[model samples]
Target: MLVVFDLLYREYCRARLAEMQKLLLLAGESAKPSKEGHGAADQSHDEKDSLQQRGWHAAD
Candidate 1:
């Protein structure tokens, strides 16, 4: 039972990581043109602010 639980947990983690990677890739593609047309620094600042507002932190 313990071994089965471990395997299940690992599979769940792998699926979740894959989903996150896909989302990140999509976001990157969407942001490319905007980043190039605007300024890199401005885009970075906006991303940081948005993340902060959403309660995400580097320390996390």
Candidate 2:
């Protein structure tokens, strides 16, 4: 029973570590500047329009 618990705990830790590493990689990528010069402004504008079409008011 102790051996089984240890194995399960190790597997859980490994999975959590992998998930954390993936998130760190994504965070690192997002921190880099956009190569096209335009950044969040362009993306936000498009998103705002999409939201309006979906009846998502800013005040709401």
Candidate 3:
């Protein structure tokens, strides 16, 4: 039972870490201006919209 719990906990931590990394990447992307001269805010909005279209939610 303890081994099983440990495995489950490890899996949960791994998944959480992956989610956090994704959120951090999105945040970093949102903070940068687009190469095409677009503002960071506009770029962020576009990214969020794209994520929403794909059924993914951006961190608030």
Q: Best-fitting candidate, measured by lDDT?
A: 2
How many angstroms is residue 54 displaced in model 1 relative to the true structure, after the best TM-score fit?
24
The whole-model C-alpha lDDT of candidate 1 against the native structure comes to 0.88
lDDT of 2 by residue, 1-60 (tens): 999999999999999999999999999999997678577898898798898877855556
TM-score of 3: 0.55
Which segments of model 2 are wrong by more than 4 Å?
Answer: 38-60
Please, what are the lDDT tens digits per residue for candidate 1 over residues 1-60? Answer: 999999999999999999999999999998876435578788898899998877865556
- The CA lDDT of each predicted structure is 0.88, 0.90, 0.89
Cα error of candidate 3 at position 30, Å: 0.7
Candidate 1: Cα lDDT at 60? 67
TM-score for each model? 0.56, 0.57, 0.55
Local accuracy of candidate 3 as per-residue lDDT tens digits, 1-60: 999999999999999999999999999999996578678898799999898877744343
> Quick one: best TM-score, which candidate?
2
lDDT of 1 at 23: 100
Candidates 1 and 2 compared: the better one by lDDT is 2
